[model samples]
Target: MSPAATRTDRLPYSHSSRETKDADDHAACLSNWQQRYDQLSAGSFSGVFEEFCFGNVQLFREGLNQSVHQSGIAWPGSRTFAVPVAIEGTGWFGGEVYDAHSMLTLGGSDELDFRTPRRLEILACTADARALCDYAQQVDHRNIEAELAARSIAPASPEQVTALGKLLATMMASLRATPALLHHAQMRKAMEQALFATLLDTLASATTASASPASCRTRQLVVAQARAYMEAHIDEPITVADLCIELGVSRRTLQYSFQDVLNLNPVKFLRAIRLNAVRRALKSADANGRETVADIAARWGFWHLSHFAAEYKAMFDELPSETLKRRI
Candidate 1:
């Protein structure tokens, strides 16, 4: 254990016990965070953040047999985030102890050192000590990099940190519209999976450095089996039923899943996707703006003038005629 805050610092870390039960107030929590911030400046963290906790989550603060000296600037006492399978919305904020990495499990136990307000002893909580069995599990990196990291955050570019902080702060702001999904055992598991998926997408986008265009064959793969059959005999009376034969599902089932997952369907979806390729070719042609809408449409399998206009309008908002005018 470390010593509590001395009177000199402005960070108003309070000394409340776990049994107090009233520490969960959002107002009080925010106030404490402000005071802590007053005392501590950014750029003071160095550690493998082992675990974390918030007000009442410290189930065994006494058991750890701890002593921490409070910074006149830093709030007194360490707050460790536990092995939180899930913490819904209450536990983080803009200026508060937003412990993102605390949720990750570490194989070795941590012995954290601290300097006053700016530097902190890792917050101590019931879950600070990771069991050997638990360490094997790997997890996602929350999209947030600490705003104070050397790469993206600095006093010179303070707004960058501020902007990132606002984003992280705003996350889960709407989640409370639902029930206590954070504390729920099973819901937390589902959320963990959800968060993991979200992390994957975020990491991919961050590393990829572009909104990579959706690929044709990859998109076609959704309708590939059905599409191959459709293309084999464009003149044959191959309807949605024929598609069902090649794809191995009833028409309705196919439509529902394709529309639900990919936001497109078996027939019209294929037509739009195929036509999109043609449109791209026409727009980027070496002899730019020469191709007529009807020429492009016919090249991509659209024949009926009225139906082509309707589908084009539905998909691209403008009429095929308007697209031609622009191209001309």
Candidate 2:
């Protein structure tokens, strides 16, 4: 698909508001991030993305209606800080569960893995890595480069998180209400400074915890190995027994590992991953080509057409044929 054109009327800065019913389209709404989202829950997908960019700072808000697994990287030379303003259920970032009081940080070029629940709303700030480090050093006399590189999630006081969230909301609201403010050089600089100060203050109050136990790390590794194996053999038939044999673990241990790390059994996780793979293929298929839905499903290990269609509709709220027909 061609990239969405940027709005030129906003002038020196960029502002965009987008709504999408397809998970992949929603994933593409954010600028500069290489993102992919797979819907994990059973429902029609709905998402809203709003972004404002000026100078080296970017702010965005994302609201998603379905549970989704997001994987990608932020802009190449920036660091991102994100917090959930509202969430219906729990979310996991880099294999660790986080709540409203937790902040997610990712360095430029770092891989991102997040599992978010339905009705999730998040506000995120991204700034040039060098600029962020310089601001922290100048204002707080603290060097945060190492901290940003090492941490994926940080625990912050409720007050700190709430204040940061409010500040982000205000900045976005102000820009959206009076976009001409973005054209004013002094106003843009002031907004950028305010964002940096608030974000740094929030980080300054964060508390770190001890590392995970060796046993826990082992389980995480098992989960990682299983995922890699599944991804490599996505088009082949796979079973939990097969995974156990390949990974050299007992069935119980494999089950416990998946449940502990992802809060899901092996069967469900495998099915979800394969289903998403099929969806991607269907969406990208040539509209005038000779491929059928059954062929794609079979390629993803779904041998039964009726069952595959039912499961596809149940999870994505659309038949496989419908998805293929609506390919863009």
Candidate 3:
């Protein structure tokens, strides 16, 4: 029984016997780790893959004070997966501390660093994944989902843990909720199956009508690429036609993907992005009063002052001038 981790091509169905032994230094902290993992160890299943929607949950490792992410993707289609899974046991890193609410996203092939001096538990995700992929062609959700998955290694969210704790408490209180229990492998089976079924359905139906997920109208991989391009060239003028050429798809195809995946046409997407940049600038601009709404708006590509103001107000519920006016 050691704190050491065993790697595998897939989850080992019999890992419960792997026993977690601790160094004398970490042994005192075992109860903390045990308590945290036990709180969220739903169930396990036999499979090469398993998934779960984190209702609300969180965890803090044996002996850490703050969670610090190691290295991970924060954007969608960045190869960071958006699958949901369980949180269990002590992690491989020293004192795997985590927050009960850091908006975590989980995927394979990534490592996370967490630090919380006390025990922690967390879960985020809801029962309503809501028709997984029914709107995959919509670019917005896919983008956000991709980004969420990439950022999953960051931390758990309080909202998430609350949901998870409530779910488990209601349905699993009698089964086991102790850090000292030998193992709840049998109990974990149902949870694991649910996760597997969810993953299979979601990943399979990720795109509205792509022959497969990889080829969806707005393949998450491709939209992620487009977002990156837009971010890099925020100051430059980008057109839908340009994006179509860059993505190697026709204009209609691009529009269709964005429409389905994000519920937005390209122009709207670009405007929203530009407005965001303007808001950022306006927030930091001094009313020592050097910046003007028109100045910032035009710079961010919003040339028509009246039009930009209307759009900005609609999106952010505030006017650019209002933000600047507050400074006065």
lDDT of 2: 0.77
Greater-lDDT candidate between 1 and 3: 3
| Residue pairs in candidate 2 whose N, alpha carbon or C atoms collide under 3 angstroms | none
Question: Across residues 283-327, which tens digit of lDDT does each residue of candidate 3 receive?
Answer: 888868666776666455443356568998998898878887766
Higher-lDDT candidate among 1 and 2?
2
Better of 2 and 3 by lDDT: 2
Q: Which lDDT value does model 1 have at 121?
A: 25
User: Can you tell me which runs of candidate 3 are displaced by over 4 Å?
Assistant: 1-219, 233-242
Candidate 1 residue-wise lDDT, 223-314, digit = tens: 66666676786544344444554565444445555665567776666666655654564555544445566556545544344556787788
Which candidate tops TM-score?
Answer: 2
lDDT of 3: 0.40
1-328: candidate 2 lDDT, tens digit per residue = 1011233453668888998999999999888889999999998998999998878888999999999999998877788888899988689898788877788888887899999987899999888888877666554445677766568885467898899998898778767766655555545555666677677667763331222233778889989999899888876556554576677764455667889999998868877877898899999999889987766765554534565689899999999999999998
Output the better candidate (2/3) by TM-score. Answer: 2
lDDT at 111 for candidate 1?
A: 27
Measured by lDDT, the strongest candidate is 2
Error of 1 at 222 (Å): 3.9
